[model samples]
Target: MPPPGTFTILLFGPAQDRAGSGQVTVQARVECTCGELLRALGEQHPALAFALPAARLAVNHALVAPDHRPRPDDEIALIALVDGG
Candidate 1:
């Protein structure tokens, strides 16, 4: 479980559009993985529901695998997929 008083997250590209900012801070309830955090965020922000499927998450700038645990102060970034040529 997260020790106390801290949670971290970042938003980029179109994910930032949904969050309306490039950075976000949330209070952590229990120590969890990046996926859990994303789920929670989606719950808190319904507008993010649609974006979740296409979004990518990173922990401390490194892409997090599906079950990667999140540290209390881990810098998480949500990236929205973009396509172009």
Candidate 2:
């Protein structure tokens, strides 16, 4: 598990492809908002920078607004838009 003041984000679909992994650790305050997390994600994983705008952050299995502050126990996932017919 990541140390305190960091977030472990679960990646899915294209996000996983870009990051070359199923998860990533972002450094931020415990009170950081979802938007800040995304920013940290982009900074930490430059390959995923372009995809940030369209991606969504899920906390505790529910899609949350950018301003939402996630708790340590919250399940955080980065969902990229899946393209299919």
- TM-scores for the candidates: 0.76, 0.89
Q: Candidate 2 regions off by >4 Å?
A: none
Locate the minimum summed-lDDT window of 10 residues in model 2. Answer: 1-10
lDDT of 2: 0.87
Clashes of each: 0, 0
What is candidate 1's lDDT per residue for 1-85, written digit by digit as tens?
5457356567666767877877766654656767777887787767667778977687787887867877776677776676668
RMSD of 1: 3.0
Clashing pairs in 1: none
- Residue-level lDDT of model 2, residues 1-85, one tens digit each, is 6677788899888888878899888889989999999999999899988778898899988999999999756789997776879
> Candidate 1: deviation at residue 78, Å?
0.6
Q: Top model by lDDT, which number? A: 2
lDDT of 1 at 65: 80
Best candidate (score: TM-score): 2
Error of 2 at 46 (Å): 0.6
